[model samples]
Target: MREILTLQIGGYANFVGSHFWNFQDEILGLREAGFEDPMIPTHGLNMDVLYRQGETRERQATYTPRLLSIDLRGSSGAVNPSGSLYERPPPAVVSSIHTWQGPAATFKAERHERNKFLQSLDDEEAQYREQPGDAKAEEIVDVEVNERQRYIYQSLEEEVQFSTDYLKAHLHPSSTYQIPGCWQGVTPFEDYGTGQGLFSSSARSEEIRDRVRLFVEECDTIQGFQCFVDDSGGFSAVAADLLEDVGEEYGRTPIFLFTVRPPRKVYDTLASKKKKITHALHDSVSLARLSSIAHLTVPLGLSQVAACSVAEHLAILDEKDYHTSALYAAAINCITLPFRMEAVGPSDGSQSSGLGGTDMGTALPLVSCSDSRRVAMMQASFPSPALLESKGEIFYNLHNTSSLTPSTERPKLGDRVAKLLVLQGTQLPGTTGERATVGQVHKSVVKAHEITAKTGRFSSRLATSSHLAISECPLAVPLPFPFIFGNKIGRFGNILSRTVGGGKQGRGGLDVSSVPVGASVSSSEAVLPYIKRRALDLQRFALSRSTTGPSLLQDWGFDGEESKDLRERLTNMVAAYSEMVESSSSDTD
Candidate 1:
């Protein structure tokens, strides 16, 4: 019964945020064939996001309370968000109602005495001056004054509420997809750049306040909090602020952060150098600052796929790497499984058997709460066929074994320390349930807890003649996927493949692979060096540019020197990535 609030900030984040919710919704069986008692994820809240971009029209048109509750009872025939009455049934229909409380005899005696006293007023001049009926009277009337004040206050409150609701209704968080009993932050359409206006907007602030007052405080057995921050400045800022406030008051309530690194879009030829450099710098500074706020932060990058068993082995011509998000989105569902589906439950004959997993309330401390503040990133691995199609299927079977080796097993091989979220295998995907063996759990736990090695130590440099390096494995990720709305697909292949064993990569981007048949497996080879290098270049450009670059950094509470420091640290990794891409490219002479 432990509760954790899920906060989604920024446009892309909302997409991923929705996937996270969808996963929970599927797991708990809160949809069509409802579970006996479906529950929110043990990892965090269902989700509250400031969504922009691709929002459903229904969500776009509504202004729901940032905080809300759902009635699975179907009592709420329509979408009525009426105050507290939403929970309890309206006062039962009654036979008769009496309004008067006083007896007729007592009322008449008091009235008679009052009339006599008023008639016998000894000081006519004093009484006349005090009389409110007199136009010239100067006396103050407390009752009238209170009444007017109350009217004005009520009107103002109503007006303010209306305006806020109007704006909130348009936000992605306020949309129809939101879960019952879940609270959301106000998603305002008015985005003032990335940092403040989006995260600390008036609406955003009010929503946070409401979330704390309503959800956080109300939960009697609340555990920790988990936040998903997009690369946007405001989203992370607000998330940090809210977590800090709650942490100060709640004392030691662990807050885990899942932040999406700004994808590298500069590789596109049409992209201007100025824009590329600007984005890179902006992202680096934002990530660096965000890293410090969360107790433990997991940063995700699109470049992660460069280290995969298949993709890295082959060459990808599409520089856009648009599928990176899709891949990450799928990875997110798998990696977070340890926390979300703590214990597997029994299937009640649901079509997918997705509800076989149970909550790991007792194991909360194992995954959700991280004491180490250092190492704010982890490497991400996604199996073949992108996420939108695979649903939650775990690809790259041979990558992990029945003996789940820790992502950090080879600690001494590299100098740059890193962690990997190697969520391998296909089990409990949305609508598709692959029985999870206790042996698998044992392997996953054994490796998940093990602290691994650093980045490449002796790996050859990319372009530079330098010897320093980082293994793609060591690059830090949030330990969660980069799921988004449309990007997080649940392609379970054909119903035939789903029913049988692993086979082919389907047109729907579904994986046909059933159980691991051979020695081959799926694995994530982190191309972190490329990711860090890209960020470094962006940061360097930001620092090298005019005062505007530095000012932008300052505006977001990041200083110039720190940005420079980060770039410096990423020097080796960047070089290694450059070499890998160069050597890996088929066109290379």
Candidate 2:
């Protein structure tokens, strides 16, 4: 078994990770419930790849994700830090106060109460424990449990108070670590340097390192690390430091990093302008540093997701982390699906090794283009158009769900590109809603390739390679998922002819069980603009002497020498993309 250790870095990263884990938990639940789908007979998924099984001190079996999450104090909301699987020992009694020799003041705060959904989960667990051997009793207790959970999920507010509110997976006791002396609203952890010196203390750094080493020690064959970081804030620095330590300890282990951010609202004010400048500088430095340590880095999140083409058919709130994180979680889940697949046979020279088997080591190079371009962009089509319409026509449109490109213009010819496309749960065209077999899916992909070739979708001066991976199993939407779908979506994530309204309007009333999704991670000239924009912002603000750049740099602990180094690093990154484009164009001419 090749194990991949997962890490979630900040509040928003945890928000995205929470949804990702919930999807995994839902799949596990379905398997345990004996749920079968004829359309997807062979899932080919090995859950052990991402999970670990062990026994607690009391000899109770426990199954949990091999994950490590770091966040600010009080960010976990009502979830216990040690989780609920293991029993907690009672606090030691203090019989005497010999140090102070005086009355000590005591202040107690109100405890957090569980939400309705969590309460229901507790009740179900209690009932299950009461009758562990009684199947009839279990059935009776769970008769209307799903319906109740769905209703509660639907009634949730648009804003997510905390990531733990929707988390479904049970984490190990050491999986979560909250930074001391840091609170979300009270502490100002908003810049690239705010997290500096946080782990300088030997005790803190050693503790975190020990937690990671514990998980790594258990793996027989370690594949790599999968990291999700919130790059919009100080967590970028935190993640970079952690990864550097890990890289030093574990030589040459590939780290696939997904840097994410929630949508931010733009304001027209002097303060906002200064803030934006600082943020731009932070972003440039964060990307440069993070990408250096990571084998492959994928930038995620849009400034305004509601304005993106992917949200055209759906209703989403731009300010809600709950809504935005769900979209990111879906894409992340689908893109990483190839990592857990079972190896069917020998390699077939495909990018993903013929869909029979693939790992982070094999998959990272495909999108990174042999390390010449380590940074890539992600685009996905959630609820992809793979089903037959009511008029018997099949639409294979894959929309741009990512913020990598704001426009829909075609790329210039002679631009080199490498793309990896992952399509899941697609049905064959002309079928009566029957899921496509593996062979049929391959045929559909071939047709897609032919169409793209005719339309010049991937025309380039140099060679361009596109790899396709197909999976019959669709992404299952758990009850805790945010209500982001529109009224036109059907139960199975297909589009309907008319809008149906029976539940609350604009509240995602449609009962979407699962969705066919298409996602691609690519390294090409198209992502040049994204890189150049940040580089330009950094140059205009940080490298200029006429502005407040120098003072801001000093405030972030970047001395003159350090600032120069960062600028050079970012400039080189942008130059690499430009050189690729120029080289391709020159060859074509």
Candidate 3:
């Protein structure tokens, strides 16, 4: 069984990656038929832990990855690039403060005070009153010796030894924490950059390259790779490029990218225009390059998933949308359902899925492919029904295995059929045989897609229906599996009475096309809105003399020509889908 290697670049990506691993099929172990012998035993690569503190010198070499270069035990891979990087500590300058600093100084001071007290006691020779200030010095010293010597020894309470932990606390405590996880149980761990990120400058540096070489060599059994690039376009783009190079050198490995961006609206409303422009340029440039390298790249951003405009309480939510990483993590667990599931078959038995005919040496090739037509597919995913304020048929429409959502003007599903995998969460309420069973979820799936001439937007919203072949990818893909915790219950407020579509008075299923997992539009179709917006923005920026005509793209290592090429291909690709739909209808007529 070919295993897919996963890599997380930058901060948010690492956060998502951590949760993804913590919530998968192998949280216990992998047990598929052909996948019996896992391909990527080492699992994956993580870049955020690069310059970790003492990880190298202190900790035992047990796990390949631990978190944050903040690690009390992360490797010291930082290089002294310039002045005073480590010129030397300037010979321990002993100054005024050093004399009275610390326990030793306190001890010396105490001893000195004690000695002065003793001297005072001794100096109290017979302080001869009156004029006797002249009693010979030898006689005074003789009297003092005789007086104090007569008073003998002193005693006090017995001393008690303190606890070992206390001694350790004051002395030295263990600095390294035993973090969980390993690359297939243990080997050479890599550090990719400074604590902030692997900046563009460091992407191709010798240190990072060496680490990549080592990572690939060890992943001899890997068949495919999944990468996470969250918001850090410069560094992540470079890293993604390096992986692409590696894939080309050894095998034409299919690389899937999950590029997460925060809500653009959030930025537009909250950030400076220059910052927004900077983000836009970085995002567009990175998307262009990363798209070229990966077989498929999915965009994840807050606003992309349109919350319903229905009653105030009717919005689609996944438990909590507080953290982007958590939401993306939940989505990852949902999207990767096919690999984790028992081989497709009758619900009665535990037979192995016999589709050994591997594509590109990988098992589930359709989910991720090297097809140029399939690249840049729009992605959407609904973690569970709990995300909805109201449950029932409308709740069913918000989930998709392909993560496809409707485009602004229409749903993005293309002429190709879609494959849906419905992963059930434990929160799914049902009695004994009724709760979240395959049959239950299957019914929910069918109910969500049921078409009635009089039903909610099913008639007019079918914009490109005739030419587009909805079932040919073959048909919509859905998978219903055992319950998962990521789909929590009671997180979204108690059920409310509401309409499926937007208006408060309306009562019907959601304009299913508009919900989060609303529809199965082709990724190409789904990306049009964002792409068109980007193209227009870039054109102005790339054309303006003050902006240096495409220098931003150049700075980020994205070629101006390549940007135009990809954008053009996508524009044409979406158009072709429309043309195909139109032609099919004409032939039928």
TM-score for each of the candidates: 0.46, 0.89, 0.52
User: For model 3, how does the per-residue alpha-carbon lDDT over 1-589 read when each residue is reduced to its tens digit?
Assistant: 3444456554345546544543332322232223432211212211111111122234522222222111111111121111121222253344665465456521111111223212332354334322454458658687675444322111000110101100100001121111222111132222111111222235333444454444444453555566776544333444555566656665667666677543432345677665666656554445545665666666665554334222123233322222334346555544443332323334421122211112223322343322433334333334233222134542245333334322333332222322323233312332111123234444444455453224643333323211100100000111111111121112221122332223322111111101121122233234455555555565566556676436655554446676577466544444544444564355445
Tens-digit lDDT track of model 1 for 1-589: 4555555544445445534443333323332344322111122212222111232334433322233221111222222334221233375364577686876331111111112112222243366567447553434565574454334322321232111111112222322222222223333221113444333456655655564555555454555555655554344544555555666676766655666633442235577765455455655555444544555555554433434442331222222222343344444554444343233344222222122232223222332223222223333333222112133333222133121111222122222222323332333323442333334423333332231212333232211111111001111111111211122222321122223222231121122211111111111123343246546555556566453566655665556675566565455334543443454443333
Model 2 deviation from the true structure expressed as Cα RMSD, one decimal place: 4.1
What C-alpha lDDT does candidate 2 achieve relative to the native structure?
0.75
Clashing pairs in 2: 414-461
Q: Which candidate is the best by lDDT?
A: 2
Model 2, which residues run further than 4 Å from truth? 39-42, 89-110, 132-147, 265-273, 346-356, 370-372, 387-414, 430-433, 455-463, 503-510, 587-589
Give residue 303's error in model 1 in angstroms. 5.4
Stretches of candidate 3 above 4 Å error? 24-26, 29-206, 213-220, 264-266, 269-277, 304-322, 342-372, 375-383, 386-420, 426-434, 443-488, 491-524, 557-589
**lDDT string, candidate 2, 443-471, tens digits:** 55555445556776344332367666767
Clashes of 2: 1
